[model samples]
Target: SWELLQKKVFQNKSCLSELYDVSLEVAKRCKGLPLVVILVAGIIKKKMEESWWHEVKDAIYSYLGESEEYSRGTVHLSYDNLPDYLKPCLLYMGMFPEDHNISASNLINLWIAEGFVQDVESGRLEEAAEGYLMDLISSNVIMVSKGGRYNGKVKYSQVHDIVLHFCLERSREEKFMLAVKGNYSNFRLSDWKESRVSFSFSDGLSEIASKTRKPFHQHLRSLRMTLIKGEVSNWSAFRQFSKLRLLKVLNLSSHRVGRLSSAALQALIHLKYLAVSARKFNFHPESHLPHIETLIVLCPFSRTVLPPIFWKMKTLRHVEINDVVFDLKNNKKWISEESSKLENLRILKQVAIKIGADDNVDVLLRRCPNLQELEIGILCDEDSVEICQLESLTQLQILRLSIDSFQLNVSKLRLPLHIKKLVLRGTRIESIVSSIGGLPSLEYLQLVLPTFIQLKEWCLGDVTFHKLKLLKLECLNISRWDASEESFPLLERLVIKKGHELEEIPLSFADIQTLKQIKLVQCKNKSLKASALKIKEEAEAIGGSDIIDLIVKDKGFEDAKKIITALKGKGISATEAAGFCWG
Candidate 1:
């Protein structure tokens, strides 16, 4: 994991002899382990000041004196050595709960909000922020636990326990942020006089402090509250924090905040990143927050009505919601000639959309021409969502089209050529698959079938999906999956889940050398299981077993177990009886 940093550390030389000596001393203490060496180098690389280098050298000398003992001070040294630019970014991560798998995009957005990332000569501010994240990853400061299938980028990242501990310690030492856990009586505002950021893991914000009570820090820039407990009564406390003119990042996701006063948000003009999870949020008609750039509303099992105040928020760069109905038609006054379009919007994901054509979703998409990723849902039956309108979004790369209509026509839907990943779910149309194979740049595809739908057969013609890498077909009744070797030539992972009628695996799959993993979940087809066994046996016979992994869940299917036993009898590896119960 740290090998990349090791190579750079060993090959890069310092101009000054004294600097080299200090670097060598640190390297020698690392004992050739990549993790330690990389951590040491990450700090050393930023030590351009002679005084700072000397301080670091002295610290390393002290740490080496007690090298025989197992102490976390070694990793803490790396945190102490971080460049000014990256210190806050790493420390901000420690604000999240321990063992949390943070989203790379969210992390970058937060960095941008806190002014940690600046525009470089090579790219925009966000792009530069991404580069900084990559630097940390290369330095072994963060690990990529999940990779994006379509774009081949890091989706989820996590900090190691030792690194996280170091972040907490250094953050306290620097008065970067104050963390308050459990009850509010134990938290004192006077304790955080030097800190501008606060992380509260309190049981309930309502139980913390009264709004009328004087705040400890008037210049607080960031406040993140996680694992909030109980109902919130008076929002007066929140209105008090509105006076924090420097506050930019506020996350209330862990709490069940049902209502918020518009007065609470009107004063937060400097807020750039905000995340809140609630059943519903009310906004004042006169409320205006011009600096808010990233807004995330997570109403997982409920709906959050986005008030009309959002239409005027033109500075938004990214917006994510579990359920929302953006009714622009009702708020025609918000769309004046002077109103700026959402050209800065790069990512928009709406899990459940109540208002469709009436809301003018297409017109909104046209305004957001630079949108790189989009996820929307169509829930109305009479709504005519012109998916072709998406063709105008030339910069769009990822799309998820979800429709729950029983009488909607998608026959004329033409997908954009630039889309790299697409997810289609709950569509009753039978010809959806035929229209999807023509996507030129599509690399990842997910098709989720609706129950009681008429769709049955799926046919992949030759030369289709030329660049496809991952294909997931779920809850389908496609008994016949016809394909050729020319189809999905570049496919790497194929996942078929809950497909009860899928009769057999495609023979052409064995011909694709790029194929690596085939996962079948709750698929009862015996022939399909046997075909998987045969494919493994054939690959092993030709010394290609290393290139393939066949994973299956029988789901209590008797014949599937017999097939597994037969494969084992043939001297092929099988772990079939260990079924996964979906119930």
Candidate 2:
């Protein structure tokens, strides 16, 4: 509690030495309850006055008098103290299921769709929503469940049971949203007057459709049906949603459902956010959703062909479709049109662009010039279609390129200067690793090459990855790696997967002060494992303790036990000796 208070409130400010006693007293008043301590700290962090601290201490003391309801009182006080703008955001958390780890991106998008996040000085709603999330996180109202593997940014977040309960109660009081869990039979349609409604039950849509013969809620703006189990076989049930003319947000992407008919969505002219899963998707956004800002189509069964009108949606900010093909051949005239530019588009993922002789991806990329994250697969076998125009996308930060059966000649590839994360699959980069290393803003680089075409030798002779933090090499045949600490001065994590032919990691990596974790997966080389162990030993010898983590994984469970036993014979603890496997 004291540490958290110091970090969040004091921020290691030595000038606040006089408040140490008062802060300790305040922390002690919470009785070691983490949430209460965090709430108290968040309340007092705004003011540095000694009198204010004392007042906060007394206020917490008053809550402590109610021993049975102390936690609830403290939480309620915190909620009451929240700023008006943030109250709705907090209450919105109840819309998700209990114990559900919500995606930060999805939550922010929802907040944006719900008009909870107001415009900030930067004019980006996403940034403002992120600030709100961080504020809640700092206050301990929200918990960071998981972070991104490469960037370490919060990917998943969840609220505690107490907080969730509080949010649900407050939401009910405010009539903000209705969350339907378990059977839909208990749900009363007349009682649901809230603008937003979320269903966490099976066959929720069918039940509601069958119950309501007419348009039930014309005032409803958002509706989400999260199927926990079983697929919705009745595709016709979706036609019932057409009555919701004012619906702004609709999500039914949890389970496999039938193709959403255009007629069902034709009446949803006010829809801004749409997420649906289907075997085949033929919904035309240009004709149907004129105001759609976020569109997500999940088709895991087969590749869905996106219509040419997909590129013409001007209001789209985020587009994510899995296993989808874009037939840009017929869309050439549409691309050449001056008004086809998607200036608001920020994210485009898992989109396979079919490049032919007459059309190139450059023409398409020129339309969406402001894309921040792009994951595209070049579906072409000809060598003429090369990714040479990515440098024009100066705003791009994350890029994943997959060129199937095509060698990505790095010499010809001109990457964006500001890209922070780059993942290349089915591409050859053995000859020109220096070109990629020269990226000034790159922090994470993952190379997952095909088995038949392996990177033989990667020698970092004179090049330096100045800002690189994580380097992942998978399915590579490189046997010799000539690198020093100078090569990757800021690298923290090293991951090698299926590197069967690689001899060992360079001993010089042990000397890199910033190195923290070295993970080897299915790499049968005993010498490579020994090299990682030696790095740990050397790091401990120099740094005075075990500062580095070594995780090794093979294919066999028994071999992992044997390796753990062997490591235990050494000074390694059981926790540190885990995660080893053998092929």
Candidate 3:
């Protein structure tokens, strides 16, 4: 708590020392509550005057006067002081049930769709919104539940019940968002006619629909129905949404969409975001959802196919599906015409399209030059020259290729110049070092090739992988890995999994200044653990830091740790020989 406030308020050490008594007095006013201390600290972080400090001390005392309700007033004051743009974002967080850990990615996406996020000079709208979330966490408004493994970004965040109560009261007054948590039958929509967003955390959509009268439907811009019990409910009442002229976002569970009408959905021309199960909604060629910018379809079926009309959405910004197939063989001309209209697309994921001999993927990629992230699966008997066409996506940053049913020559794989992360799964690659060496911006790579057999030795040449940070080799048949410090100058994390034939680790890995952690999972090589210990010793000798961690697990790590600790206690410095076995 003090660390967060120190960055915002007490950067001047000398000044903070001069006001030591005042700071200690303020700390005493907190009553050992970290939340109250942090919130109060944030509130007065900008005021540098001595009188202002005394004023805050007096207020904190008065605020905690006689009642517990008054004690919560401090948290409420913090919420009230948040910026106008952040106010709605913070309050919307309360729409989720208490104690729910919200996904940062999904929340940011919803905020963008609701027009709550705005682009700043530093980054995209989502990036700016992430900054807002971090700011909230720093101010002790919300707590981070989990952090991303690779980027250290917040993956999940949670709010306290006290803070959530404040949000609910504030949001109810502003008519920003209404959250219904109890029985749907008793819930009333008469008082929420001016509300712009609505969320239901229970079942019985029919009762809510029965009470949703005419003009009340016109004021809603967003509707989200979440069924905690995962029960199947009738959605025939959703026909009322056809008259929701202002509706922009519609997210519902697949079970609730059983009776969703096709005609009513097509009438939502103003919709910008739509997420529904593919098996529930019937897709036709003439069914045009023109204004949709972000389309997410959850497929519960085996067939991976999308309606032909989806290809022609001109204003599409992001498209995601569980699985999808495209017929570019017979519909080349029309597909090209439709794809050319998607100039604004930034993200396309889970597109498992089958390619023909004459089909070229360049048709889709070349049209969307602004695409930043793409994941597509190519199902073929042999590698197509079309795979090399990805070089046209000059702005592409993240690429995932799932080549099914055949081998693709690793040397022939060509990626865009700016690509930063790459994943190759189910592709037979003989060697990867030579093909990926020249990538200047590549930072993360994962190769999963269970059927691979051609690769025997991976020779990473000098001064390759200049900016690579994370490398994961899983389910490969490689027997040898030859690398030097020059191979991965900036590599920090390395993971080797299911390498049954692998026998050793590169000792020169210790020479890399940035290497921090190495994990060997399910690899039974005897010399691998010895090499890891050697790497740790060498790294400590050169850098005076034994911070490198080697995690090796085949059955259990704790049991291994216990055995190793016992051996060390007995002054027996053991080394690996043959295979590991414990009686």
TM-score of each: 0.83, 0.90, 0.86
Per-residue C-alpha lDDT of model 2 across residues 1-583, encoded as one tens digit per residue: 7776777686766538778789888878888777777777778876888888898888888785554367777778778778889889898888888889999999988888888887575337778888899888876678899997767788999997888888887777788888888888888887877888888876766777677755465658888877765544343467676678889898877756766544467778888899888877775645657788888988777777766676666788888988777667777788878798888888999988765566667888888898899998877656554554688798999999887755544457788899999998887675547788889999999989733333456777888899999999898867877789999999999999988778778989989999999999998776677667777777877899889988878656356657776887887754467434322
Q: On residues 18-91, what C-alpha lDDT tens digit does candidate 1 reach at each position?
A: 55555555566565555566566666656455576566656766664443332356576766555679878888
Residues 1-583, model 3: lDDT tens digits: 3444454466555437656677777777767666687777766764666677778778778676544465478787777667878878888886677888888977777777777887565236666878888878766788899985556789899988878888887778877777776567556666764445445554565565566467456677887776666555545555666666677887764343442334568878888888776455455657767788787777656444455666677777788877766666655676677434577788899887666567766785676778889998887645443344578888888999897765455456677888888888886554545567678898988888745454576665464787888889897677887878888888898898888777677889989999899898887665666576667667877899776777887776556656765764575443431123232
Q: Lowest-scoring 10 consecutive residues by lDDT in candidate 1?
A: 574-583
- Of the two candidates 1 and 3, the one with more favorable TM-score, higher being better, is 3
* C-alpha lDDT of all candidate models, in order: 0.69, 0.79, 0.71
* lDDT (C-alpha) at residue 392 in model 3: 82
| Global local distance difference test of model 3 | 0.71
Candidate 3: residue pairs that collide: none
Alpha carbon lDDT of residue 403, candidate 2?
77
Off by over 4 Å in 3: 1-22, 41-62, 65-71, 119-124, 194-202, 229-240, 254-264, 278-282, 381-386, 430-432, 450-456, 522-534, 552-554, 569-571, 574-583
